[model samples]
Target: MFTGLIDKLKGKRTAAVKTPEIMGLRLGASFELDPLAIRLILDELTIESCSPTQIIRAAGLVELDGTWVYRFYTDDDAWLQVVAEGGQTDEHVVDVKLFHFYDTLDVAGQQAWDRLLQREIGAASYSLRERTYGRVWTSAGDYHNPVHMAEKTYDGDGEHSLTDQFTMLFERPLSDQRTESLFLSAEEKQEQAGYLSRSLVISTGITLTPSQLTIHG
Candidate 1:
């Protein structure tokens, strides 16, 4: 009976772990490792043992058959969706969606954004270009929305926009310049694009759980 219980527990373990090191890489802007910094963050994270189903449910990584879906809430009240399939080795295998909280914006600003969308003024197939971060769509493109939000006042009371509000709430920085030009040394634009593609995937979201071992046929 003891052996059987151990087998069950082993079976309950999933193949993924969510540690601060992984989270830092996932949510962090840069892909390059700062070994010391990563070590420090990892040391601070509280480690625990839990079943795969529990961990997945807690982290919002739901599994349906062979497909896994994860959702992450960004600093701007925008939610990002990531869907992954089993055995997929490519970064492009992950599907990303940005859900903006439009209701958070004021009437005038919302209208301004609506007009831009109506005209198809800044819609792009991809949320972020090879060189930008956050929702890249909008009238101003890339980081413009956040910057605009910072400059706007609520009821002319010198208050920041909803974007700014969330940023402060989440303690996420407005900008991370360390990895801004990580791909600059690449010999070609294609190389730079490839690097950015991978970096974006790595910096999308973070998890704070332990890794699990699983057996596969």
Candidate 2:
């Protein structure tokens, strides 16, 4: 089910992208690649696609835990991750950590990637926000954030069976986080601003250093 979705992309893939590594699964997952590359495995596989937040919630609810997991993408400053593996009919995506590893728990350099992300996907979609939590998520274990689904399509006659598309989930960005101070010294303000950062759900392969996201234009 290669949609050329990631292939035709120059960074902004989806969820601000990820918000994915879009790897090509092969025998490497079967024989050569480290077994640690695998993330979650589906048995009944009831869903076509889903988000990382959903998976994290399910794990907490069912008490399923793992140290061998990782995030592939996000839209808003790498804060929210969107995962939906429904299109792959060949069913070969295993140990996807090849794209990355579990690093969303840290929020160091969380800022401004979604801007680049939203640009690639034109404005031709619909969005739904979380009923509560006036704020959005910036990582894997935060509140469920809003989503902008792309590629709207219809079924049959195109009037009665219309359904919103979810192939790509684009998360909406919230206002920036900055220090509010008019009475503080310039140095103090600058230092405070340094603490301000977007939510981060991914990081370098295995380092405290935040993953440096590549931005275009």
Residue-level lDDT of model 1, residues 121-194, one tens digit each, is 22232222333422333444422221111111121122222111111001111222211111000011123334
Best by TM-score: 1
TM-score of each: 0.23, 0.16
Off by over 4 Å in 2: 1-86, 91-95, 98-198, 205-217
Rate residue 69 of model 1 by lDDT.
47
**Model 2: per-residue Cα lDDT over 151-187, one tens digit each:** 2222122211112211122222223321111100001
Q: After superposition on all CA atoms, what RMSD does each candidate show versus the true structure? A: 18.8, 21.3
The clash tally of candidate 2 reads: 20
lDDT of each: 0.28, 0.22
Error of 2 at 170 (Å): 20
Cα deviation of 32 in candidate 2 (Å)? 12
